[model samples]
Target: MRIDWDVPITMDDGVVLRADIFRPVEPGEYATIMSMGPYAKGLSFQEGYPGNWNRMIEAYPEIAEGTTNKYQNWELVDPEKWVPDGYVCVRIDSRGAGRSHGHLDPFSPRETKDFYECIEWAATQEWSNGRIGLLGISYYAINQWQVAGLRPPHLAAICVWEGSADYYREMSRHGGILCEFLGSWFQRQVVRVQHGTGERGPRSPVTGELAAGPETLSEEELAANRINPGQDILDRPLDGDYYRDRSPDFSKITVPLLSSGNWGGQGLHPRGNLEGYLAVPSEQKWLEMHGDTHFSPFYTDHGIALQKRFFGHFLRDEDTGWTQQPPVELQVRHPGEKFVQRSENEWPLRRTRWTKYYLDPDGQALGTTPSSGADLSYETTGDGLTFLTPPLTDELEITGPVAAHLTLSSDTTDADVFLALRVFDPDGEEVTFIGSNDPSVPVGLGWLRASHRKLDTQRSLPHRPWHSHDEIWPLEPGVPVELDVEIWPTCIVVPAGYRIGLTVRGRDYENEGVMLPGAMYPMKGTGPFLHGNAQDRPAAIFGGVNTLHFTGGVAPYLLLPVIPG
Candidate 1:
């Protein structure tokens, strides 16, 4: 079906953000699906992000079938699918990215205002039926939370797929530890598509001018006009207003949303999706969790159907057979790269029997009860302690976010605790999964600085733990302090003959036999001392001789979200 594409909308600021509008040529109004973000609007899935796009298409071949691949953009709804279904799919280049004006700084307050304006503009178009919805993955998804909070009049609904809510926690810092993802991400992706001063890049197939603007400025003019704000991110290490402005205020977001999360996306995406789903005040919300390569399912036939169903209900006012659907749909992950579909009434499944395995210092094993009064202490830099369980006779599935409650005395005022969940086979070999950092790594991991363990009870959920970065709780030299460490969520199936183990250490988890494979994108290195490197973590910030005090009087345990067999 031939549809009108690459339509331009001039914002209030006189900056024209280009859009690819796909709608039926027949004289009929249709609901609209709009997305605005970086990652270039014209860059094809097969050409721009080949590694990710290829994996996605390979796993879901139907994505590439039956349509001209021209309308496919990175990390957003495929226009071909939505346009033919009596909906106009609109893709906009956010100001400063792709074919948009202004400087390239993501999640900036200014950019959010632009998004709000863009939404209203789309709503007023001749082809729009006064209803619009936001749909996309990652960048497009992340910003929806921010804009939805603004409560645009035309934003009828949103499908936030695998987007993060807390910028500092998910994107910048992991457990108060600085992640190199921001720096590497900026260098590799953002800079390339940044709006330039000249009429470069793919011209709008409709306008024939540069997709961004009247490309009249020189390269120097483009660079000079942009805001090079990378330094601000590096300087701010806490959850200050800078991060807050970029994050979504859950209270203000009331639009119906379908929040999607990935089971294996521990580093940046999954946590926020879960957080947004739970935190948003929207009573009309749904949660869908899936397992697969990060970028695949969002574009697949299965994923598209879900997106269309949700958008159709909200945007088109169509009874798309989605109302009776389960509120939560999870692609329950199984061993050997298999997935089973499961429906649930709510997240952290009501039947999720929260089991706590206490740390037995004497035998270094995880048990149901504490072995009273036996205090054991270990060097902060040493192997620390491992609490292991014997091989299970039956298959066990542990999914969702895990936490560790520790009662410990530290030698110094501050300490860092690194928690790792490892699966060991009968022969004692560690089971590893393909991680973004390392191809072969443990199933799940989490970390926390002992002093930074203050909890925000109001924000904390049973399955998800939220920390208050409001103040630091200093260690009392030798007095035992109770601390809870929040680990990123994961889904793993431990078959019979495999043991579940929790390793509490002072540093990051680096597999000695594995060299850090060059990531598809560059990431900051953790430094020489494997696990938590000392260079990235200095004595002043993370320096402290830590100790784990586990005894009979006080039980330190790992909280597991074990799904019933």
Candidate 2:
């Protein structure tokens, strides 16, 4: 393999972004695989993300097979494995990250335009094919959706693995409630590797040079160079240019797409992947939903194999059996962390039995028929309520999106609703699975702010309620308002004698004794995607008694997509 270190690619604005290109030594021309992100390109995966890397290496020993693993970077394709497979791999340090120098603004239109220029630059290279394919996890994948909307001429395909494309709804805010994930993420992950950290940051194990940059910058200078992502998000409480500028116009994404989501990824990934598949007008697209940690699966044999086949068919025009690929692929989850692979023609499966379980406040149970019951109320800071069904008479499978219809009233002007779907064994022990970040997570999670309950009727579906976060309709205290909450998609197959549960909480859900032991932050049930921002949820306003009223002739109920055998 031939390696080009710190190759300079000038952008349209004369900003020269740096990239490391790995390609076959005797290559004439090959499909180019590229990723540009805030994470330094020179930083080794093991050094940049020690905990995740160590855990992945321990869980899947096969990940260390056949390669040195020294070149691995976070959420990026391993060059050692791909360069030898007749593909050109380019990893760019996006403007103001790593060695590149510019004003750092992630997810900004400027960064996306830079990416467009990089794709064009890679296409004109001596050992590069005119076709460019984008492949990466998280941040890398997020940008692909943005740049693809620009319709770069050389861009041919994209594989968005575990990424959130909708900045406001799926990322910064959930149902108009500000999420702490983006702010925490920008601080812990992005700023740590931002350019100018220099000598203070870790050095690249491969090159023995500063991973951030060559010059150490003062704190004041560093602050002036980049925008505060967290504060920026908090400032824009209502969705407008702030988020619309960062998010992709899905309809403009016409490139071949392979969107892979993690079913257990409660907060971030699931919505975007499913939305991309359903919204993108791409003539050729596939959606694959799986179960596992965020970083591990991207490096495993299964992930690489699927990527190769997809890129092989689209980029190289080689028959890698992708011609027989189905429109939707699901790793159907079962009890005991088991996943069974299955394929279908479309998402939410056309044959799904859309079942509704009425919420009986009096019994604190879910039943087939709507029951006239008393209203249920709880402290805004407490575990609101848990409604469950009796043991199933036979095995039941719920394999798609879920929704909840409820009539709510709060003492304050607003209320934050946190929903958790869970499954329990015959003995009543709660069954949990390994999530993208958290070790144990519920079957499905959803959130809503009563003030943002106004729906985008045109975009809303029975199973998925799309909220127009553009405006807020403050709650009239003590007055009932109907809310249709859209839970992220999930897959679970419960056996007979097992009960299905739903816990509606006033705050982030937490497992009694579960915590991601080496994670940068405490990842309870909902990972780091907590929504307890003081400014957004001031105690004086959000801290109050919340009620679930079963009235207006429409009893509250849970809408589930049950797939028939």
Candidate 3:
């Protein structure tokens, strides 16, 4: 392979974004795969992310044996794996980060437009073949949706590997509660590689050069160069034109798509992949949902094979038989990280039997029969309560979106309800799964801020209650109101003698196990996805006594999409 280092991509407005291109040694035009992200292009995966790198290598050995990995960037494809296969790989440092020069504005219109121009510039290159496909996870994957909406002519295909499409719903806020990820992410990851990091930041171990920039700058200059993402997120509590402009319009994306979501990614990954596949105007689209570490799967033998098949068909016009593949592929999860592969023509499988399990206040059980005139209250800041079903007599498979209906009153004007769908072994041990970010987390998780309980009826389904977070309706203190909480999609198969447990808490879900310091996101009570901002959920508003009303005429229940075994 031949590497063209520090190539300048001049945007229409005269800013030059730096890119590195890797092409086959043989002189011939080839379809291109590119990633445009704020993460420095020169930050070698092994050196920059040793924790994830070590874990990924141990789990998927073939990944390291497959290539030299010299060209590998975080969450991006290795050039060694693709360049030899008649594909050119390109990595561009988004303006104001890495070697690029400009005021850093992450995920803004300027960044999206610059990405569009970069795509077009790549198409015009001599080694381009005029066909480019976007490939990566998270930041790299998210921008593909945005640029694809701009509809660059040479953009042929896209592989959205665990990317969130909606900025507000998936990233900044969850059910109207502001999460700490945006702030933590900008500080830990973005700021280090930002344009003015200069001598203040770490260098590229491999290149023995500054990864953030070529020139050193003062502390004041560094601070002035970038936007404070966390504060920016806090200031904009409501989703408005700022977020709308940052988020991509799926309606305008018509390219062939392979949308891969992680079932355990309740935080940011699952919703967008499923929603994008269902909403994109693309005639040929595929959805694949898996469970495991967010980054490992993309480099595993299985992931690369699937990606090659899709690009083979769309970009090269090769009959790789990807078209004959099922429209949806799901890794139906089970205990001990086991999964049963299932293929279908549509999502939420047509055979799904939507069932509601009523909350019985008596024995803290989930059943079909409703109890009467019962009110169960829990401390808002405490480890709320757990409702379980009798150990299953037969295997139960749940494979789609989950929701809950609750009739409740709080002493305060607003409250936060955190729900966790858990699994318990016959031996009485709580079972957890590997999430996109967390090492151990419940099977499924759902959250809602009582004030933002208004539903988007047109987009709501029995199993998936869509919330319109545009406005907040403060409750009359101590007044009962029905609220529909939207839980992200999950897939799990329960064994006979095992039990399904639902835990509702005032705060984020917490697991009892090892927390990796090297995780992409820090493992907080809920794996860095906690929503306890002082501004969004003040102690006075969300810390008051909350009550769950059930039985009587009002039946509070949890909805599950049970699939036939």
Model 2 lDDT per residue over 333-385, tens place: 99887889999999879999999999887778988899767788989898789
CA RMSD, predictions in order? 3.7, 1.1, 1.4
Candidates 1 and 3, the one with greater TM-score: 3
Which pairs of residues clash in candidate 3, taking residues 3 or more apart in a chain or in different chains? 371-551, 372-552
Model 2 poorest 10 in a row by lDDT:
512-521
Candidate numbers sorted by TM-score from highest down: 2, 3, 1
| Residue 325 displacement (Å), model 1 | 0.7
Give residue 524's lDDT in candidate 2 (0 to 100): 70
Q: Which residue runs does candidate 1 get wrong by more than 4 Å?
A: 1-6, 197-230, 372-385, 408-413, 434-441, 461-463, 474-480, 512-519, 522-536, 539-545
Cα error, residue 245 of model 3, in Å, equals 1.2
Tens-digit lDDT track of model 3 for 1-565 = 8988889999888999999898998888899998999889888888788898998899889999878777668999988998889999999999999989998888888999998899899999989789899999999989989999999999999999999988888888888788888899887888889876777767776576788878878878878978887887788877788778889999999999999999888788899999899999999899999999889889988899999999988888898898688999988898889987888989878999999888888889988776655689999888898999999999999888899898888998888889999899989888888888887878888888888898889998888888878887989888888988888899999999999988888888876657675766656435778786887778988887899887444698889899887
Q: Estimate TM-scores for all models.
A: 0.88, 0.98, 0.98
Candidate 2 wrong stretches, greater than 4 Å: 513-517
